[model samples]
Target: MAAYAVSIAKEDNMSTSDITKMLEAHADRLPTESGTTSFTLTDLGDNRYRITGSRATSKHFSRILGMNSPTLSSSAEIAKGGTPAPCVLATNTSPSNGRGIEMNNNARMTISGCSVQSNATGSSSVHLTQAFITVTDGSGPGKLCHGGGVYQANGNAVSATKELCATVTDPLAASLPTPTPTGTTYGNPGTDYSWYGSKTFQPGIYSSGFVANNGRTHYLEAGTYYITGGNFEAQSGAKIIANGPITIIVMNGGTIRITDYSASANSFQAPQTGPYAGILMWRVNNGSCPNPITFAGGAGFTYDGVLYFPGCLLDVSNNAHISTRSEFTYVLADRIMMVGGSRMTIDVDNPYGLAANLGGGGSGGSFALVK
Candidate 1:
């Protein structure tokens, strides 16, 4: 009957033909059990649930479904150049729960260093609060994910040995790319207006929001810089240059920080290919964090790409070292502050996989488990 009822919510880049078009749009307001295609449950929230189907005339899509596969989400074994490409995320919507990768500068929250390259694990990516989150600093390299939870404080431990994953699939927040772009809308360069003697900027849609007046030397002529009311800031400077596929989209408000603490001669670079190739800076999540965005990268900084900007509260301070040398970097925010000695590296292979295939974390259809 209409694929055994409908109402398959749980969105966020949903796929599988959008659940067979929502079970062809309801089976008499039924709502449970789907057989024509064999049961297909999906919730994946704290309680968790995601039972795909294949061979069966009907065993259960209702009755609370099922979760017998040695415990649905089981993962452990990834640390040597294998599954480590959500880039660098801390997408915790901020109710404050260990702060994902938030460090107070005691040092040791290196999710991938700038130089001493060796440890590059962090498979599930790293999220916190609800579940599946961690940070380590005992031996580095995520300590090969001991998965027992031990985020030592007092010394600011990120990994005395951390790793408790079962599915944090946020493969780039639904294939990202929506900074609101229509046509031409730029304004508000007030306050004695002076972008450091105009270096060169020709993008679009500013809408009463365009103020970058720090020790400047700007040059962004690539495309897309849709900044809303919140006057963008790249202060703490002596330089803030952009010479590539550029993109900087902030939303409703003001004083939204992007990069500062003087990355020295900041040299931004994204769009290595097209369609905003990894991404350069996107802070448009109007859920909260009124205006908390202070991202700094030091030592003559050279931004490579991808700084997603989830909900709010993203401040990676001081000697912030992001994207190190870029092999295609990424950084999701919504509560990420590895204060002072912040070292958030990038380069686990993104040759533009861009979420592998897409449908929420790419690689199409993905989930498979059979014995």
Candidate 2:
């Protein structure tokens, strides 16, 4: 029988239907099972092939081709001119061993639009070493996995242009979580400078000095503190330690002058706090206090913490000189509105090379400057 034929139609172009008919005819020429008809269509051209009906089993197809019976060389492969169209093997019934598809060492394969669900023990999906695999949307809804979605290892690198979505069945089981924003704030200056603690004033004109006696700590809190009219000198051994947290909120349009009075070693400590520690002036928070705060004077000031202000407006016409004794220095605020004609300088230096967490955590946060 001329099982395979090449016929020329009116049009010179050869159609795929013609090639399929030729291959089917060739397959039918082979011997059949005793009483069974000796007609079948198995191989497609271009190094690709297919199996259908009851003869689709590994044994039946392997015996006809004279090759080893494969556990799963299952799908149909279409011929595409030069190379073989990638094979797609699928199964209706679950495999006892949970093995889905296995490709030859040199087989270049790609799987798309499939799903693996309710599998036990073995991985839901597997890609071997040196295998290039890509998952893409097909005619259907796309791929899904229940047990272990897709497992690609053995030094394999996977990449996707789109986002990967997954749902976890259990909450306690190790899984990724959505992130939240928790910002840091300066301490309250009123409480920090009370008789309980010590407040360090920069080189500036203060009417009164910060009096500390008998190991007592006196510092200011976030609220306003009264000071007489005089040059509040930061003497040779003047240091400010915030007993709790301190935020210098200038209220009633009061002016505080911070100058660098140290002839040699002048240092200020600005420690990190939670949600409210820093410099705030000309700002009103009706929720807490409705008084407007104001800040003035720009002398050389050094703080070993973060400088932040959101609600208050600043006048930097007198550019303040700021420096840090330690290498770790971070300047962060809710909103920094630098007025025209003001100069501000910041210096961060730590001799031991220690980096402090300016935003509480070393990394992973947001910083914004609103007019």
Candidate 3:
């Protein structure tokens, strides 16, 4: 599955060069609202192209994604719109192999203006936590959750209401693929760097590795990207635009470290079908090195897929957000942490649907009512 160059666009005035400049500049740090509406790409030779519109916005908020010493700041928050969905799914048995959220023993957490709120009825904001779910506020309710109304999970003695359910369980970790892609067979095999400028990427497996943000913008064609034997990193001033549903799979000792803070605002979504359906980023379970998945600083990092890192720590901070567009979104990890005004929101208007449709055992799950 080697990656090839792909160009898809409906507008003509926007030339390849102009697109390149826009991507490189990232104009307003994020694709302008109008720029993202009908985003497209103009072919520019080799494996390169330019952004066509404003990057869509998506953030993730589960009852609880996963936890091992998870930390949340007073500025942190977890919220969703439409229908109803749990803010954090704590227990692994809740659903989607406990895909919503989980915090095993030894996992610690800190919190502040953080809360789990929803608009829909019946659904609570939290699932369960093996570790203590602390609230940072000293005066007001120590903790908050939206279960139709604002429910106090933890608060000062007199104002305190319910307690977070503590059901400890060592949920099953995500199993590694039996037949992993052999970097040799799949996608385009090439070293197309977008860390300094603008470039486009086609679908397929990127066996070698991928890096962005030496100060540039990378445009990813609508398809699946398999990163093998290397790491996928995006730093300051790096931007990624997806023309359609996309999937990034990290395998063969490859890890994912995306720090699109302040400068780079990467916007990406995962495919809705196939083995990696609904998965925005899939970090291989490296038995030895528990490399963490760091997604921080991208105030406008829109993702509508599940970030499945069963054996790694998933840390999202610095005002990052994960939201759903057309489908549902979930985060499954060994441990999870969200701080610095980070948030996760789901839209029941377009929910993930039944658990069975979410694919595999731990791919995704439905939200359950918390007592």
Candidate 4:
């Protein structure tokens, strides 16, 4: 009897479709017996379900069940079910070339179950510098086979052997302009200003810490915001909407933290040009311990600016979507980490182009390495 049951189970495993049909037919009457094996199916609600049974039956359950739609194939393909990643990670093909993600210095990137799609059609997905890249748990270039792979400056961009790898030069080496702090002392050092709650402000030097929280929306006019001391935070559904050009300068041990994972997460965007051209969040070297600058927002969050903080750690994640809806985005930080389903875009066909103000164009500074 035992031999007979094992034989029957092996035969049943050969055809997943048949097993699925049997399961669906008996959906209302789960925990049914199938050839001496009892299986239990529980509806998890919201079109999702969970099934448990003998090892042989549950093996390859998801693959055997199969998805109605295609999954993430490469970093260059748009996400089929979830939010599309902003960077391009596809390989290069004919006529149309694919853009790639670029990371620099000792920075690291890790991606899992995410699709890094190209900004445009027929472009590569990733362009990485001398950084470590890691991909695991079903992460890769999406859809298109060509122009959806890893292009590294030193060697193969991807850490996984199964990834499509190629050789490419670091395009961002020249574009990131080093900020030369120039100005007579504008504000006294060690001053603290806490601009909290909901309100609007004109552009000028903010001589202290700036905090916006409690579902507040702070509006800033076209100008520069100089944060002299302490940290800058926008949390708890807080938002900073820019009506015109704006720049945020974090100095004297000051940092920037944008948090709260909700759709109304703390969010803001800077301009694309002017005296602060190609620069948005600037943190000067104040001889203090480096702090992490966190950016968290919803899918509508689109930031166009250069985040220049050579003395700080950059944390960009949390279902945030920094679309390339504007001109471009450039950053120069001590270290960087991008994960948590965040999509930071670098549009390929934009009129302003990548780091245009800093004299960047055509594949330079266009890649980020995922470690």
Instruction: Give all candidates' CA lDDT scores.
Output: 0.47, 0.30, 0.45, 0.44
Instruction: Give lDDT tens digits, candidate 4, residues 1-371.
Output: 11111101210001123233444454333332222333443433321223343312222454577833222111111111222222223212221234333344444444332223222122334445565555332222322112345456754355443333232212233444443344323342212234445456665555656666666667766767777766767676656677776778777888888776343433345655565665667777565535777775553355566556654556666655554423334444444445555545443224233324342312222111111
Tens digits of per-residue lDDT, candidate 3, 241-284, equal 78787778788777777676433245576766666666677776
TM-score of each: 0.31, 0.25, 0.49, 0.45
- Count of clashing residue pairs in every prediction: 13, 53, 47, 48
Candidate 3: segments with Cα more than 4 A from true spot: 1-179, 182-196, 261-266, 349-371
lDDT of 1: 0.47
Alpha-carbon runs more than 4 Å astray in model 4: 1-197, 261-273, 287-289, 297-300, 326-328, 351-356, 360-371
Give candidate 4's TM-score.
0.45
Q: Sort by TM-score, best first: what order? A: 3, 4, 1, 2
lDDT measured at residue 254 in model 4 versus the true structure, 0 to 100: 83
Which stretches in model 2 have alpha-carbon errors above 4 Å? 1-265, 271-295, 324-335, 339-341, 347-354, 360-371
**Candidate 4 deviates by what RMSD?**
18.7
Q: Which residue runs of candidate 1 sit more than 4 Å off their true CA positions? A: 1-84, 89-154, 159-223, 226-232, 235-246, 249-274, 277-305, 308-315, 318-329, 332-337, 340-366
For model 1, how does the per-residue alpha-carbon lDDT over 67-186 read when each residue is reduced to its tens digit?
432212211111112222334544442243433453554333433321111111232223222212232221234332311233344533333234343333455656666555756775
> By summed lDDT, which 10 consecutive residues of candidate 4 come out lowest?
4-13
Candidate scoring better on TM-score of 3 and 4: 3
Ranking by lDDT: 1, 3, 4, 2
